[model samples]
Target chain A: MKELRWGLLAAGTIAAEFAAGVDESKHGVLEAVAARSGDRAAEFASRFEVPKCYGSYEDLLADPDVDAVYISTPHPLHGAWAIRAAEAGKHILCEKPLTVSVSEAEKVIEAARANDVFLMEAFMYRLHPQIRRLAELISSGAIGEVRAVDVAFSYNFATPRLTDPALGGGGIFDVGCYCTSLARLVSQAATGQDVVEPEEVLGMARLDENGVDEVAFGLLRLPGGVLAQLACGFQLTQDDHIRVYGSQGQLYVPKPAWIHEMRKPKTSQIILTPEGGEPEVIEVEATQGLFAREADHVAAHLADRQAPELTWAETLANLRTLERWRAAVAR
Target chain B: MKELRWGLLAAGTIAAEFAAGVDESKHGVLEAVAARSGDRAAEFASRFEVPKCYGSYEDLLADPDVDAVYISTPHPLHGAWAIRAAEAGKHILCEKPLTVSVSEAEKVIEAARANDVFLMEAFMYRLHPQIRRLAELISSGAIGEVRAVDVAFSYNFATPRLTDPALGGGGIFDVGCYCTSLARLVSQAATGQDVVEPEEVLGMARLDENGVDEVAFGLLRLPGGVLAQLACGFQLTQDDHIRVYGSQGQLYVPKPAWIHEMRKPKTSQIILTPEGGEPEVIEVEATQGLFAREADHVAAHLADRQAPELTWAETLANLRTLERWRAAVAR
Candidate 1:
């Protein structure tokens, strides 16, 4: 298969990480990078050893050598840039959350479908091998019909852009998206559905002076009587834990964020406790960085026209849930 | 202090445990045992080595030597027995749920107040030293203004009596009450209030053919934007874990049930994770069984008129929260 050429849409922190991941991937190459300033784009190109640098996203997208674009811009800018990339006939891997609201997500998805381009939300942690194994265990009925899921993703983050409502900043959009997505993923894995929608959603938030939620809690009732509890905040320190309880037993994953998988190979531990038995720890090694695996996954879709791990319908469902949660909390 | 004489009401499993704990206490003595049948009372007395046995609950309450009674009857019968014991001028330690509903709890409390007798719910887990230490840490702002609590108390309980709907057998009355009570306890500790009431509650459940909930989930919005997630079931195997997340850090107790503390001395572990720091495990050793601690606590209240660890107002608040949860799920 021909190697898929990549273009970095922003020279931000995440963009640098993606460039390194692209360099490490076996089926992808970094063709060009773009930033608002030419000097910043040239510096990123020099650091990642890319062949070309463009001062603007449009210039990079128009380059014939770039086959796909990775959008790492701020949350509010994702939809506009992604639609532009789709119009330029480039496949897109946009960072999470895909957009700030459900309507924006809908527009991005429609643009991708109309332009006949592949698009996936960059939820890199879902591409980790440990997550796949966990999903397999749930699908195999290791925990016998999941009844409830408890997820928490929190950190004491402080930044102007992160706390600014104008920048689409808040715990829900920043980190809570992971908790919601994982809940949906596990629900689908348990019930064998391509996508599962929450029947009911209740949410509470502690908002800052800037009208951004510093802390948020959400409860969702999924189909088949499955319940999920999610917590995300910028003011508390959570260990990034995820627990799924079922009729027969339960499984817990500490450090579900897979932080080490971003920069280097690492191992993750999953604790499985069966009814009337002791807890067993299962360790899974990811030999490749999560970003590289994600890149390869996108490459497979580009090469064979295979469906990406995250489907468009599922993305829309998740965004809608987020919108409902925000609405509930606002009331 | 003089030894407080005790009477065992209803020769059930919990009655036997309470009898043993009374025997182990330095300030309590088991004076009599009571059951509907004289033979059953005598059998329980022989097993626990009590001196006297009575055929009916009234006869045991009439005994002059029985200064306090431990009520261990089924859920639907607790209020009646406790009120009767209070009228007989005996201090009462009733098994948890306290009663099946909030109104019943109110009547029991009123009866005890009218008779000028001490009444305390036998939530033995609360008497464990680890729980006390955890409360102290929260009060000391170890976690800094508690924001959310995640609690689960589940087991595969399968007794005919436990599954009988007419007997008020269900996860909410049986196990979910613990989650609600703990949430309140931590909330009070955080806010330095004698009791805390949830502003809003939402619940969902999976009920069996008997119309008894086998699994239940609840979300509560407490004062000051604090939120709590609780899960309880008779169908799942949860290790009874409790996690409290706060502004500065979080704490997790692995074995929150502390059921084993009823008979044997044990050590419980609490993990405290400060913001941007490693988690530290704090171990607390219970020199005496939790039931013994409970017995001593009652003895202190009887001898010096000391207040019990769980107050009547707090118990009522917890029951009201449980009632709201049940009502929400029923809808």
Candidate 2:
């Protein structure tokens, strides 16, 4: 198989994890690491055992050897870096909340389209086998006429970069994007459509002193009368489960995000309960880590211009919903 | 203990359940039953082994042997019958919602006050030991500064009474009441207040052909910025779990509604996961069925004019919120 050489755009925690994932991928190789400071970039390269390090993002993007770039910068910097990478003729796997707002995401997509490069949002959990099976079951009517979805994703981990307003930091942009994306994915699967947008959006948030939301809740009314209730927070510890309710049965994933799926081998269970019947547990065995699968998916898209796991239109729809939710909570 | 002679106000499915609960209660007796038809009333009386059966509601209200009334009629009839029962100098346990609207609930409360009688809405799940323990834990800060609640209570069972407009049918008035009541209960527990109402209410619903909502979703913003997302439907089957997210930890009740707690012995579990810690499952043994507990609670209040499990103000607040939700969805 042809290898896709990857350049790490930021020496952050997630970027480090992505590098580890790339190391495990059969069709991807972490070729370079980049940071604002030379020492940080060199340290990251040494840690990851990459061959090259760049003192600045522009230098990494300018490297002809870098076949694809993973934009793992802070939430606010994703748009500018993704556009620059696309302009430099490199495929892009941007970390989630692809940009902080819809307009920024649109610009990134436009840039990618204009430059003829592969651009996909790095929503690694969607590449997991369990989530794929979930979508398949919903589409196949395992639950029968999906009507509602409830998701709770929250954890009590706080840092200056996560809570600072200047950094575009908030639960909505950090972890809430996952909830929004999952809602859209399930709605699309149930409707068998390419895209779904919420007809109505309502949200509330608990903002910290820095004017960034620590926790947030959102409700969406999708087409075909599906109601999605989502809760995301950086201030609480929750079970992080996703439940899909349908006319005949229900499906539950104990760990919908599967955050631990990237670190080690983990077994996940999908519980299906038909109306007035016993619950059936379907256990899924982990083969490749979630991020590794994501890396391979990105490599395939880069090789043949195949469709990304998350399309550009779907990402824009999710960002639009997120913008509306932020506005609702602010009001 | 002095037994309170209970009169069954309707010969419906719920009414039968209440009759069996009264029979099991230590301080309540199933004395009489009434139905629109004489034969149905007689049949219910025979099955429950009651001594008296009345063809008309007026006859049962006028009977001197009836010490209290359990109003188990359809949703729309609850207010009128509750007011009549209050006027007849009988203590009342009215099935939820206490009334179809806030105005009707107020009238029923007014009548109860004027007649010096006990009045309570039968939110049976709240009377269960597991729910009571949940409330205690929240009030004691077991989870620490509760911030959000997500509840799903749905089942795939449709009947004329559930889907017909004339019967005051809908998912919201039937099962939705349970979700709304649980949200309020948990909020009140977190805030340590006797009453708490959502500052903002937003909802969406899928109305069936009769203009009755088969499925409904509501979002509430309670005091202290707590967000509650509730979904109820007659068109689907769900896990029917209640999750409370807090700043320090999380608490989850596997069966929040405890719908099956009335029929047989069941042990429910509450899973608590503190920040960065493993979840601890607390198993609670059901000493008395939920309905039996409700029957005993009503009997105790009737004997001493003590407060009922669900107070009139709390019921009014819940109804008012439900009214807002209906209006929001209609808009």
Error of 2 at A261 (Å): 1.1
Give the TM-scores of the predictions, in the order they appear. 0.95, 0.95
Full-model lDDT for every candidate:
0.85, 0.85
Give one digit per residue, the lDDT tens place, for model 2 in B7-119.
98999998988888887788999888999999999999999899999999999999998989999899889999998998999999989988888988899999998999988
TM-score of 2: 0.95
Candidate 1 docking category?
medium
lDDT (10s digit) by residue, model 2, range A1-331: 6999999999989998888889888899998999999999999999999999999999989999999999989888999999999899999999987898888888999999999999988888888878888899999999888888888787888998888888888888888888888888899899888888999898878888777888888888887678888888788676788988887788999877457577564788889888678999988877887777788899877754435568898789889999998888785
**TM-scores of chain A across candidates:** 0.96, 0.97
Worst 10 residues of 1 chain A by lDDT: A302-311
Give candidate 1 regions above 4 Å deviation: A303-306, B303-308
Cα displacement (Å) at residue B145, model 1 = 3.1
Q: What lDDT score is found at residue B27 in candidate 1?
A: 97
Query: Candidate 2 — which residues are off by over 4 angstroms?
Result: A263-267, A303-306, B263-268, B283-286, B303-308
Residue clash pairs of candidate 2: none
